[model samples]
Target: MRSFDSTGVMEQNISKWELDTPALCVDLDALESNLATLQQTVIRNGIASRPHAKTHKTPAIARMQLESGSVGICTAKVGEAVAMYEHGIEQILMTTINATPFKIERAMNLRRWCPGFVQATDTPGNARALSEAAQAAGLVADVVVDIDTGGHRTGITAGQPALALAQLVDQLPGLRLRGMLCYDGGAQHVRGFETRRARTLETLAPATETFDLLQRSGLNTEIFSGGGTGTYNIDHETRGLTDIQVGSYVFMDAQYLAIGGATDDDVYSDFETSLTVLTTVLNAQYEGRVTTDAGAKACTINQPWPIVKGETGMTYSSGSDEFGTLRYDDPSRTYQLGDKLEVIVSHCDPVVNLYDQMYAVRGDRVEAVWKIAARGMST
Candidate 1:
């Protein structure tokens, strides 16, 4: 193992153990397994995967996904799409609605660099704005109509409203309606398999009906996209979905496992838990508790405290900005100061966004480090 010098520079090539604590680490083997499983699953179902890149936000992983037979990638924001495009990912679907003038202009500018860039809209006003902006830029922007398939986050209600918006987009001068985007984000974590499946179907009904109405009206819907990690398999059961936009499958988390779609081996439906936060115990003065160097700032506190990897009796709790308290029932087991512990984050998305880079490791060896290129693209 290489040691950090007085200036905090390593003398030799760094291994996983030699790297600083509280680091974001990706198990390369598990990551490869997850990527392959998703590719195989989508291919076996005769559907295409446009994996949401908002989870990892790393272009290296996105390129790997594309190489693994993914049709495209989906991003949560226009800025994220631009970042990905700058990394050489051309086929990107900006899932979030870019309505504001600045964002719309940014999307159009992004399309200039990557012509296959597409944006989503849930309202006719936004569609018109996109059209006008794209026209002013002398570029036709490909657009998708986002249907409120139960998340109620940022989409318009599916049905006549959806059909009307599609009609409006078709009439718009510089926007081409690519298809519909229906995502039941809440249905992705329904706990039981049957309940999750039924909930997904029930919630997707409105979007399916809207698609039917649009098709009957002679509207060309080239792609019908939407699906998350929890419902990726179930999404294929539906005839209306042409592309599944699963993201978290690339890196399973405690929140995802709580949704209950894992296989018999406890894997998250064949997707392995590749991403983990490596923390070192800094304080062991307490009798029943120990402290690590990761907390709400490092790992997400939005869900539950991260699971202490491989320690069933140990429970983690939030400490201050840069610490985590761990409690254990087994008094026999003692946590020594400087001991390393890997924690499975409760939520993978925001946790990944917290770090600048992730160390890709194969066992104890650090293979490479990939930058989280779209870390703070909140636009």
Candidate 2:
């Protein structure tokens, strides 16, 4: 279906290639496998998963993750968490700092309704603001101090500063300090297994030290939440890590694949590439090159360009808004004007935001079509 609504498309043996151009297709088998693999790893390591919903932006997928043993979910924005909360996702962690009056008010509303909602904050001003609003609402807001592990992103500095923030959050009225968030976003794509592991350990060291400081200070250090799919296997060894916030494991993309894992020297194969932007060849007029309907608007234009599934020696460029140009050196396969191809996106999150629904396909059969309910919910 060209349109996003696939109401009657469920339970049909429809060829994925037959779906409309630039359709988002997910291999259910791969999806299931990825979920199981991560769950198994976390369970075995005595850690829990708080999968980030910002990647899929689907409540159905969030529910699936919870059912697969995820303790809760994480959303980067107030709007995304609100969208998820409306759809029966009770347990959520809003990972970004909600500072503005409007955002804090909206967050308090969500906190009032969902008991499991947790907010992450770094600065004292935001903590005081959240406390003031929460106290006005007559409820205690659950919050975590965001600790900047190494990425130097939005988080308070580790060591005494993190502990101080936690202490401040603890003393703030109408606020319950749950734990610390130490996400090193930069370490998640370090390109080599040994190199990444070293960087991850080095970066997370300060956070672990700060976790100790929080614990020694008699604060609730129960939840030391952080870690991505890249460092999932490595982060379990962290001194205070309780759960990992792995989002992209559900839909491995080109950026993740290039990072290289422990077993694979040049590619991170811990998870399979399940999500793909399905594109149809629109023009085959030129030799050694073809144009597809999925361009920057469809598949995204990130580096390590889209990988043509099941085909080798094919380079894809979606520099244009309307078409992705594909060039192949040798003819392993010939393409017709209508031939459909799937490409593992360079980045899954933004690519997902561009779509309206994802077709859950098992081989050539369509089992379900999950709406991109929170698509463009970024605020």
lDDT of 1 by residue, 75-113 (tens): 999889989999999999988998789988988999988
Q: Candidate 2, clashing residue pairs?
A: none
Candidate 1: minimum summed lDDT over ten consecutive residues — where? 5-14
Error of 1 at 174 (Å): 0.7
lDDT of 2 by residue, 1-379 (tens): 3777665443346877678778898999999999999999999998999999999999989999999999999999999998999999999998899989999999999998999999999999999999999999999999999998756769999988888889999999899999998898999999899999999999999989999899989999888999999999999988889999999999999999999999986989999899998899999989999999999999878888998988887788999999999998875686889998888999999999998889999988878888888899987
Q: TM-score for candidate 1, please give it.
A: 0.94
lDDT of 2 at 191: 87
Against the reference, the lDDT scores of all candidates come to: 0.86, 0.91
Output the number of the TM-score-best candidate.
2
TM-score of each: 0.94, 0.96
Q: For residue 231, what is the lDDT in candidate 1?
A: 87
